[model samples]
Target: MMPNTYTQIYIQLVFATKGRDSQITNLVREEIEKYICGIFNNKGQKVMAIYANPDHVHIFFSYKNLQITISDLVKVVKTESTNFINEKKLCVNHFTWQQGYGAFSYAKSQKERVVNYILNQETHHEKKSFRDEYVEFLNAFEIEFKDEYLFEFYD
Candidate 1:
């Protein structure tokens, strides 16, 4: 039997900063998303969707060879976005991503549904806070999560 050929995989990653002040405005958020996309594109990764709120970000990406680990990809996105924001003088204080991130795998058929959910974050947040939303994702994925580690953006 021949070895199985590599297959492309899609992942949805969610991460936020330590504080709510990280995302000051839409301009800053747009820059961060653009920079992340640019970085991944340069490395031959394809970004399927992206959405940013005042505190966190959701990114969906697909890779052919699976060359990048989730940690490596998160690090690059955070580091590059931070540098780009700083270099452009976009924000006053230093920006940083939280210590951990939430990543979930999805079937190819679910791509559109996932992307739509991400794209409508702004509207969705009107009824649900980021914390609640995050919890929902965790629950939907059936992953165990400690409440203490989950950051609350809205009071």
Candidate 2:
């Protein structure tokens, strides 16, 4: 008999636009966020919170699918979202996600905190630039990353 398996994984994904342009304006932010959530839901994942900043996005979700790797999930989300945005002409110019993304895992105990952080991205960015915040997250998570390889920071 096959043994039953169970697992819990919560991840917060961070990614920016190709040129780091403030393209995700207020006019299209809500639609884009909802579309992204749909993508996660369709994959059998539960999205706890998501916010699209002018140039970046943060998504917190409970990963339920073991068949797909995190890297593959991120790639699918980015590609589909880009297509959704461009096809809908949500932005004045074409839209595309950057090459890489930051995926930070969190304990179940920290779910509320992560959700709040993602929901408050607008408020949080008022004081801190996306570059500084991303760098801080990398440092806090003890993830080794080269500055050059990080997202392009125009701010």
Model 2 weakest lDDT span, ten residues long: 65-74
Q: Write the per-residue lDDT of candidate 2 for residues 21-128, one digit (tens) a residue.
A: 889999999999999999998888899999999899999999998788889988989999999999999999888988999999999999999999989988998899
| Candidate 2 backbone collisions, by pair | none
lDDT of each: 0.81, 0.93
The reply for model 1, stretches above 4 Å from the true place, is: 1-4, 22-24, 152-154
Clash number for each model: 0, 0
Residue 10 displacement in candidate 2 (angstroms): 0.7
C-alpha lDDT (0 to 100) for residue 72 of candidate 1:
84
The per-prediction CA RMSD against the true structure, in angstroms, equals 2.3, 0.9
